[model samples]
Target: MEPSSILVIYVTRIGDTMLVTPAVRALAQAWPKARIDFFGSRTSAAVFRHLPFVSRVGVLTKKRIRFKGWLQRKSYDLALVYGFDGDGPFVEYALRVSRQVIAFKQRKESLNQKLLASIDKTTIRCSNSVDYLFSLIAPLGIPKAGLHLSYVISESERQWAVARLAALRDGGAGPIVGLQIASFPTKGYRDWPVENFVELCRRIRSEHPKAHFLILGGKREWKRTRALHVSLSGCSTHYAGRLSLRQTAALMGQLDLYIGVDTGPTHIMGALHRPMVALYHPSSPSRALAPLEHPCCHVVDHPLADRGATEHTPMAGITVDAVWEKVRAALSGEFPPPLVTPWTP
Candidate 1:
């Protein structure tokens, strides 16, 4: 219980890495003097760059030698393993580094529970992943504070956002709507069809003539996003593959509203508590990943009727009209936020 130094390992995708922030915050709040270090992917590590609670953020690479060396240099009182997959090897390293170890164990894994204290993955069934993480430290006597997400932007970052958006900031006449057109390639089904986004944009421009779109996504999306950029030409800025995560987040913070597929930056927007509309595919349920604690954010979801049927994308079931209505409500202060405590499980 008295852990002076902790090593938290969660080597996963960007969204999963950000999901760990609330747990990290709980640890910091409960033990203010404790040194908290994160062992995660380099790309996702940027989200913690300027965060005050984390003392160090370690990036895992192809070569485990340097990572092993770093772990050897510090002795931790506690080790927290977070990712659902490939944690078997990390568990060994954690045992070597710490006097105590606790982790989130997948339900299917047959492990010796006596090896370490742990919470089974199926135990917490909160609609919001962040809330599930908040629940993780509770048995350790770390009380739930509130639903939260953390991605603090610096003043200089704010200034950079301003300078980069100078053209739009020139006393723009209408609302700024940011768009995250695609999810990572693996979850392409989560993406609203590019053609659907184009149709949605047409409707928005028809209603609000001066509205501007800021397109966001990773570099791999560049080839695919080019068409959307061209289709929505003159009214949007494509930063899909251009900016760093923090820079994209700072710019996303400036949006009057955001419309995006469920991805990492969508979580960042949630952290900023931006008024937004988030879209999700049935395979990746909105209940699990929708941004938490954004009062005005609404999830316009279209899950597949047959959960396993893949005749077409579940996203296709979400009509452009349905999304537009949500967008209109969001813009006119008519968005119906999620019903509080909506989770049945």
Candidate 2:
């Protein structure tokens, strides 16, 4: 195959869309001249604006076919759909336009099979969602360059982030730490206790008085951020629900450290090479997505004995002390540091 010009369609959550960034980079590496485009939801699309590897980004809502005819006009050589469950209209839409389609489906959709150049097997064992997507591209012979997640910062956004941060610290000295405490409410179980974060802030302030904490999250999480602020009193500044996704990424990129649950922004921070500590639950597999090929990531997993009970919730069995150990290791210079040592309990 000539590595036909690719259009990678990832119309899922922000994190899922971000994870495709490396795949975009991979396509660019394989076919430098081939056009590479990323299609995403409107909110997620904002993050791709100035990416060098992407020629264009077509933002659309689920089942909104407004851009379908336009995409067909481009005559994409190949299309890959990330969130299709085999029956969605978008699955058929991608099939209708692209010369070749590669996708994953739960079971045989007669029409889907007819349109696709290839579909993932019905019974392939997988531990992570991104791995399932990667399987589709293996037939194309594209080497797995680990999981790719990126947030392209325009020059204007970069300037905004700089000015904002300068005002926060008044040109003071300290490690700027970005802390995100809430995930979507549906994944509320994934959040570490807010009290843990409060205590963490207190300890950080006592030890490293120069250090400053910047809380980040969406409007849905504002109450949680406020609670954390109340508990920590004078220790941190709350930037939660204030900045847009790209603005937050720019702010996080300039930070000395980042700590969060397995969420969209955390994935972006990972792509930018920021030192990160990710809290994981058994429901979400960090094995497939944990800052691969980057030595600066540390993962703490709360293992589950009964897989049936795990459902991407808050990590249980993990304590504040354990989290603190990982934070200390990350601050020091250990690449892929251990989340907890043998005697931490």
Candidate 3:
């Protein structure tokens, strides 16, 4: 069956939204002529911009779901909804706007019966999050296109990034490292200690001498990032609360290396194919969440990664020396050869 118009709805956090790109890419590859539209959270919606295959991106919220598609015709030939609970408003909205709808099995048996195909949420077929999300389209028989996350940085944004980096460097040639110090409040256990970062930066600068750092995060992390900036004094720039999500990503593209806790920007950096050392907490280990088929990714997993640690597990188990070794290897161009061929759109 040929689907001329498609709608994909996934309203979630920034990192989770990035995780869905592989599945979306597979859909585009299978239906090259289809016009695809995306619905995401206001912040996560920015990720869909600059993608060649996406025709439009709109914001979606549970609050705005009431009467949303009641006034319109069923405009989409196929629709897919992700991360919605059983018989939720998001599922109802998708049913109203599309000829065929696919989603995870809802709580109510009646709602599950309504979907074109309802995926069993507990099937446990995939080891990683990207592959798990891709399962939503398995009933459609679309071949997997790629497993790596997707992000497009435009030429203008690239230029802006370059210019910003130049200004920050001020003619001094040094390895520019970007750092994300904290995760969101709920995922605080995923964050490595800020003092560990300070010690790591000190070690990196001692070896490279000319190395510089870019402190990156949202306003919630401002106090800690500020302290690190103050400790680094002349060598680091604080960008924690200053830029929008896209702007932060643009600057991240210009970095020589990125060292971060597993978070949204780490996910963005994963898509850029740049040198990076990502620290993962045991609760959400690198095997499950790290970028797949990435050429330069260096993962530092916590000691308890295989021990079935809970969210209460501290990320400090991933030491400064462990992360520093990866950082050093990345800076020296000692990355292992690509294990798998990188997927292209």
Alpha-carbon shift of residue 185 in model 3 (angstroms): 0.8
Summed over model 1, clashes come to 0
Model 3: per-residue lDDT, tens digit, 1-345?
889999999989889999999899889999999999999899779987887879899998888886699999999999999996545788889999999999988887777788999888888466678878888988888887778889999899999889988865786858999999999988988988889999999999999888899999999998889999999999998999999888899999999999999999999998999999899999888878898878898988999997989999888888888998899999998786543323222
Q: What is the TM-score of each candidate against the true structure?
A: 0.89, 0.88, 0.96
Give the deviation of candidate 1 from the true structure as CA RMSD: 3.1
Candidate 1: segments with Cα more than 4 A from true spot: 65-74, 85-87, 106-114, 122-126, 134-139, 171-173, 303-312, 337-345
Query: Per-residue lDDT of 206-266 in model 1, one digit per residue for the tens?
Result: 9889888888988988876888989988998888888888889999888888999888888
* Preferred candidate (TM-score higher): 1 or 3: 3
List the lowest-lDDT window of 10 residues for candidate 1: 336-345
RMSD of each: 3.1, 4.9, 2.2
Off by over 4 Å in 2: 70-74, 106-108, 126-129, 145-148, 171-173, 303-309, 312-316, 337-345
Which pairs in model 3 have colliding backbones?
none
Native-structure RMSD, model 2: 4.9
lDDT for every model? 0.77, 0.72, 0.88
Residues 1-345, model 2: lDDT tens digits: 664577777777777777666666766777889888777787657767788888888876655764466534647788777666445556566766677877766355675565554554675555445555566676577665445455677788778888878965685746788898887777788788898887776666666788878899999999898888777666578888888888888898788889898788877877787788888766665775565555588887765523554674446467888888888887776765422211100
